[model samples]
Each structure stands twice: as structure tokens, then as C-alpha cells.
Target chain A: MADRPGSDQVTTLDTPIRLDYHFSAGAAATPYLRGLAEGKFVGQRCPVCRKVYIPPRGSCPTDGVATEGAEVLADKGTVTTYCVVNVPFAGQSIEIPYICAQVLLDGADISFMSLIQEIPADQVRMGLRVEAVWVPPEERGPTLASVEYFRPNGEPDADYDSYKAYL
Target chain B: MPAAPAPRQGRRPVAVVSFAQAPNVRRDTAHNEVELLLPVIGEVLGNLGITKDDIGFICSGSTDYLIGGPFSFVAALDAVGVWPPKSESHVEMDAAWALYEAWVRLQEGDVDTALVYGFGKSSMGDLGKILALQLDPYVMAPLWPDPVSLAALQARALLDHGLATERDFAEVAARSRRSALDNPKAQVAYDRSADDLLGEDYVVAPLRRHALPPLTDGAAAVMLAAGDRAFELCERPAWITGIDHRVETHALGARDLTSSPSTAKAAEVAGVSAGPVEVVELHAPFAPQELVLCRALGLPVDPTGAGSTSVNPSGGPLAANALMAGGLIRIGEAAARIIDGRVSRVVAHATSGPVLQQNLVAVLEGA
Candidate 1:
């Protein structure tokens, strides 16, 4: 026979599981987020490499040394590189076609992803000048969401050679 | 560049005497992780006419993220039926690294034979979203940048730098899938033209659907025996001549996306260019990545041609990427060819992290 008996056929089971976890902000991140609450950008400088890390990291990935000394950085930075996100994904909070730019904060050596808004998605290019647009003071918290989004600051576009290494 | 730590050399000869794998599929709803791995483990030992008592050590590779539980690998040990007591270990990394650990253990002369396995069922949860957790928690993870999107950015950079083109990517996919036709374990075997592949729309810019590896559920195992034990176990054992691994900074923007310097460094320490390679099993999950790896390993352009090195004869990861197990499968596939007397010298490679940030290279030789 082409078909198998119902009992002889294989059975499949579905076990639903969920994992809920709470991650703590370490020593470097605790102060970084606290600074964000007061509308200031704080970064950590690697003494050996002399490179500034935005949002601060406990250890420099290159030197494997615990970074010390907090460095306050300006809000404006250059968009080193970016991708125009078009696909929708589960747990995604932003609208499609939004620009995710890797912003290298002024005086920071590393770049981090943030939303680029108040400009057309196609116009959001590398080397574009951008500044943070923070949420209202009452709504501000010790989270990246404290900055609503970044918008063009209308400064002259940075030259390719200045931020080429970041790309 | 700081030299990659060299693997222990001039040690007792160890060889992969046996290898086995489960059929790769898009989904296997009928079995759980333990159920899925049991038969695969049995076949590996059964084919060699050996059992747990004969194996000196046991190691496995799996990710808790796949099953969404702590110590998932501990439960997987039930498949091995580790009764009484046995020397065992586990790695959160790919099984290739587990094999590396076993190789190092074998060098101590305490273990004569070792068994290594890796498995992952990517169907249980949001595979892309789960992998995104591996990114930096402070910045990258908060944005939830999926693996494919990150790889696409690498592909875009490759194009911007004039390292590769969209057609070149399609060509790699076409060749790999076509090569998988003879491989029973391949899940995406096909014979299609590169032009037809290029006709497909982009899942992410600069990367067409053909360039992506298919999501697969599978398990693979390799048995390693040292010196006399290897000759007794296999007719012609694939001896481990050299092995090494190297890693780069995890910051994606800190390194060049168009090339894999870590792989090149690993290959140098592994002695990949010492002899003529007859086969290469590259663990490149993306099409363009294959080109990058080929250059890194210094393989000839016409790799698969007659009298030249054959690349991915088992179809590589493009056909069926079983997450943590995929990299280990490359090692097993390469050894199987040597055991079968099809090749004399072979190189197997494995990679981890975003955009090939880390790489492992191992050279195998046949008598």
C-alpha cells in the first residue's frame, strides 16, 4: 500500500519554551547610561591604544586591558557606514526603510548603530553630519532609548580620508 | 601580525578513523535534540565496530540557544549512553573546536582514541534573531542586527572595494549546489545556471537568495585514534599532519570585510601550502565568502578540476548549514575522502563569529 496505517505513522510533538533573562550593566556601562540620562555622551579611553569607545566597554577588545578614565564626547558625529533596513523582522520596533547608521561620535574611535531620521532614507549616506535628538527630560532613562533618533546637523560633509579607517 | 598560537606538533600520530552524519533536512519535527542525535552517534561507532568502552574520551558541541535551555549539551550526552564513567567534555563553539580539544587531549598520551560530535536544530526558534545575541550587548544587540543583514553589509563592502561582484557570488552558489548532486546528505543539491541564480531578487542587497546557506537540522561525528589504534580501526587513516586556529577583533568595522586575514594566518601555521592539496572542504556559509576563503587558503583558481584540488565535494555549508555542527562536518567530510583513498592531502577549514572573524585550518595526509 502507498499509505501507512495511522498508528504506524510517526508522531510529532511541539514543546513551547521561553527564556527570560535580565542582563546587568557592568561597571563601565553603569556610568555610561547614567550620563545618557543627563543628556551627556560619555565614553571610555583605552590607555594603551589611546582609542575612545562610545557607551564604554569594560575591556578593550584589542589590548585585552580594562579601560579606565571616562571621556565626555560631543553629541555630533559622522556616519561612517550604514544599511537601509527594508526587511521586517520579529520583535523589530522600527518602520521599514529606516536607516541604521554606524555613528562614530566626535572624539570616539569606535562607531555604534543608531537610527537616522528627519531626512529621507535614500539621502542618509556615509560621511553625513549628524547630532543626537534626545527625548524629553521627564521621559529620559538610563537606556539607549534616551536618544530618540539622530538628525542631520547641516554641517559640511566629512572628507573620505578622515573617517575612512572607521569603515 | 602577532603569530597565532601553533598547535602541538611532533606528537603521537592521530587520525580520524571514522565519520558519520544524519540526513540533512529543512525541518525534522518528528525528533527532539536528543532523539535526533542518538542514531547519528550509534552509526558513527557502529560503523567502526566499536563501542563506548573502546573510546578513551568523548566530546560534543552544541548551543543552548538552539534549545533555549541551560546545559543543553549535558542532556545530549544521553545519546552516547555514557554509563559507569567516561572522560568527557563539551564546547559552546562548533564541533570542529571540540575535535581540536580532543586532538590536544590525544597529544597528552592518556587518550588513545576520542569521539567528537556536533548538532543543532535551527527550526526550534527564530534562528536569525537567536544568532543576533552573539553581537555586542551594548550596541549591536540592542539594534537586533540579524546575521544575514550583517553578512550582506560585508558583501556590499566587498563590492564597493572591487573585490567581488554579484555574478561572482551567483557562480559560487551554482558550482557548490551542482557539486552536491552526488552527496546524499546535501539538502539543497541542484543543477542551475549562474544567470538563473542572478535572476532571483536580493534577500539583502549584494546577496541574492542563491548566495545564502539553507537552514538545516543535522548531526555529525568523527572518531579519532592515535598511532597503532588508528591503523587497526581504519584501512587508511587520515593522519592529522597540522592544525591551527586564529582570531581577530570582534568589532566588525575594525577589520577589512573583503578578506579573511585570520584564515590566512591559520593556514600559514597549519602548513596548508607545504604540499599539493587534492581536496579542500571550506566551511564558508556564504557564496562570496567561499571566494574570500579560497584566496586565504591559497588554493588554485581551478580547484575542482581534474588533477587539481576539489573544493566542497560534500557540497560544503551552502547546501545545508546545521549551525554549530556545520563547521565540524567539513572536517569529517574531508577525512572521509582520505579514508576512501580518493585524495592524498586535504585541507579542512572552519569559521566562527560575524564575517569570518575567527578561522581554523587543519591539514590531513594519507599514507
Candidate 2:
């Protein structure tokens, strides 16, 4: 194979860099993301307020109770609101100008942000129907990226008031 | 809707009674975060005739990415000798926010006094790339736009809006550096003229080397006690009369870079009324930021007014930018004014996120 682009050349310049990091797995968020990779969405429900969190948190924000057990949620959801990512960032895998939407899945009280792909950026509506597209079963990771991106489900447009709380 | 009963604003009565800090140097090879903080915390506590055990609560502000480590605050806690497992918390924000959290805890009435500290070693990492992480992860990060470039964008916008000039920015830097000469703890202290600064090459458009802060490694510790308890500790306690913080949307392109609405909103909520503010310590890492903050606070752009709130008496962050610790230092410097009897009333300001996207302001008074 030919030498890779940019790697084929050598230069005399040396730029010094350093990494000083203390790594904590943020272990609490692991199981929730893990559930997504397994084709299921899990959230922790607060016993006091009975609010189901999609990306289950360790503690409930309102009642301040520890979340217990897994509450699987329906993968299908309606887009609440979204913005087009016209700018790109470091370590980002997605291309620029993609739609990042807040999807409120069924059986979940709150919506989470994720990328919406396979649709025109300008055409992506606020209440469009979308479904999670999971990665190949053998390549799952403990991250939201495990679900590649939400795709258009070709369902009827959701009423604005139906998912207005998510915005 | 009848004024909502004042929301019980909690009665922790915490005032910053004592503060101490080390000289912010560009490189601190002799000490790490803990080593830099231990003595400062000791000195601050000592000044109040108290010990570490006297602190009922502890909180720290720091970022893991600053030193290329996650949970960097955890290791720095060893400096405090937290053996008895104190009621403590950590914010990924600046230590100034940590001070705010401590103030909130004091309101609960359970904690009489709290120790708040912050430290950062920006020398150990790529400070610019690390700061980019503070932006929206999806859209802004992929462009790899370093902080200097973003600050330049703000400077350009200010120029386009005719709100300021490149010479104005250079003058701010020159004055800040001159002010730092009086502050022994300042990292970058030099006597330079505005014309000389304007002659330097631009690191980014409209931002010269003099207009940027020096990368620094340092730590600061502040002691806060509630109400009468504060009066007992110091002859003049910097009573935090009003404190509030607010955040704007993280999207850079969506924000108006020329103005810090968050700072103005926070100042408004903190009850920064129009008056002769004796001293105002603002955390402006970039020189142009000082102008933006002054405008947001409704203070005169020039620091020469007799009753004007003197911005950055400790030379501010342009003297030394220590990332997570810089904001807390501003509060400490403001509190020092009250302790030294130099000012009867002052305001301490802190900021986080990119382009002044979030701000916390506290109006302090000597009691």
C-alpha cells in the first residue's frame, strides 16, 4: 500500500505535548449506555417522584433519591427539537452539518440528545418520527455512539404539543 | 407570585474571612497541585486562628483535562488531610463556583464554616486544545478551534461592532501587566507601554502576545464562616451580601460574542446596583475580556475614575491564567481588600466555559 496521506513526509520540527489525566470510568453511567448497545434503553426511576430517566442517572435531580433497577424504554420516539451541527469538533466521527436532535422515546419522561442521520439537514423537522439504528451486534461499546444514529421511521408527524416538554 | 417569600435564601452567613495564594509562575517544577495548595490553605486557616479540623465543610473546583487527568480534584484533596471524611463536593467549574457551592451549603445551617480551594497545572498539558472541550462536543469541537482563535473571533466581532479597537486591547494588556508588578504573586509582571504591545506580532487576529494571559501553575485557598461566626474570625470579614450565577447556551455560533449576557445577568441578580464600587476583581483571562466585563458591569472602560470599581487589583487572569484556579483567585483578591481595610465594598466575579458563557458574581462588604 502507498504511504498514508500526511504520514509520508517527515519534518524537523518537534511539538511537545503532554497528558496529565486521572481516569475514572464514570462507572455509574456505564450500565445505562451498555443497555443501549444491547438493543435496549434502560433508565433509573426515582421512587419518590416516579420520573423515568432515559440515560438512568445515579441520583434523581428533583427528589434526590438513588435510582434503582432498569426500566427498558421503547426505541421509537418523536423528535422534540434539534439543531444542525454546522461545525465540527475534535474526536467527532460524524460529518459537519448533521442534525443533532432531542429524541423523546416512548415510556421515557425525558428526552436525550443524539445525532439524526440519513435525512436532509434542512428537512429535519421538530416533531419528526425517528428510530435508533444500533451498531452490529458484535461491535457494541459502553457509549451512546453504540446506537449509530437515529433514522427517519416514515411515520406520521408528531404534534408539537405532544413532545413540547422535551425542548 | 407575591415575591415567593425570598426562597428562604438559607442562613449559612459565610464570608470569606481569610485567603492565601502562591506566586503564579509559568512553570512550577518544584511543586504539584497538592504541594502548591497545602501551605496556602494552612496560611489562610492560620490567619483565622483555626486549623483544618475547624472547617465543617470542604469543596474544590478543578478540571480533569487541565492536567490530562480525570478526577484531578480527588488527588488534590490529600493536601487538606481529609481523614475524617468531610462533607465535600467538587465542580468541573472554576473554584469560584466551588465558593458558591460552599456558600449554599452554609445556608443549610448545618455547616458553620467551609474551606474552598482550587488548583491547576496548565504547564502539564496542551492548554488550548484542552479548553476546546468546554464547548459543545458535537459541533464546535470537531473544528479543533483553539481558545486563542475563538478569543480572536470575539476581538474581531468587537472591532466590527466598533465597541473597541486593537489599541484598546493592547492598552488593557499594558495596564494589567503594569498592575501585576505590584502583585508579588502575579506570574507575568512587567512594565510595558501600549505602543510597544501594539508593535508585537498577532498570535491570532487582533490578539497580540501581550493581550493573552500567561500559562500558570498555582493554587489558592479561602476560608468562609457564617454570619457572626465570620465576625469572630476576622476584624473585617468580606461579607457576601449577594451572590448569583447563570449559564448561557454552549453553542459558540449561537452566542453574541461581543457581549457577556451571562455576566450582566449574574451581576443583576447579585444586586450590583449603580454606585461607587471601591474595588471590582474580574476574572478576564484575555485582555479584551476585561473591557467586555467592565461594559457588562456598567463600569467605566477607563480605570482612572475616582469612585470607579478598580478592576483586577491583583492584576487579574491576564497576569496569570491557571485555568480552574484563576476564578477563585479573583474572589480571594477581592476579599483581601476588605481584610486589608482598603475597600468597604467590592465585587468579585468569576467565569467559566468559552467566551464568558457562564458567570458568577458576588457583592462583598466589610462588616
lDDT winner: 1
* lDDT by residue for model 1 (A1-167), tens: 13356666534433333344233344666778899899889888877689888776455544434567878999999999999999999999988889999998889999999999999999998899999999999999899999999999999999989899898
lDDT of 2 by residue, A3-74 (tens): 556797543433333444432223235567778668788887767578787775454544433556688888
Per residue, candidate 2 scores C-alpha lDDT tens digits across B1-367 of: 1111121135445578999887788877655565567678778888989877788999999887876655768767756767567788998889999999999888888778999998888777776778876776656775667888988999999999999998889888887788889998988888888888889999998899988889888888899888668777887888887788999989888899889888898888777774357888888888888889888887788732234567787888989888888889999999899888988788889999888889998888775
Relative to the true structure, candidate 2 has a C-alpha RMSD (angstroms) of 16.7
> Which 10 successive residues of model 1 chain B have the least lDDT summed?
B1-10
Output per-candidate TM-scores for chain A, rounded to 2 decimals.
Answer: 0.88, 0.79
For model 1, fnat equals: 0.01
Q: Model 1 segments beyond 4 Å from truth?
A: A1-167, B1-10, B301-307
Model 1 residue B80 distance off true place after TM-score fit, in angstroms? 0.5
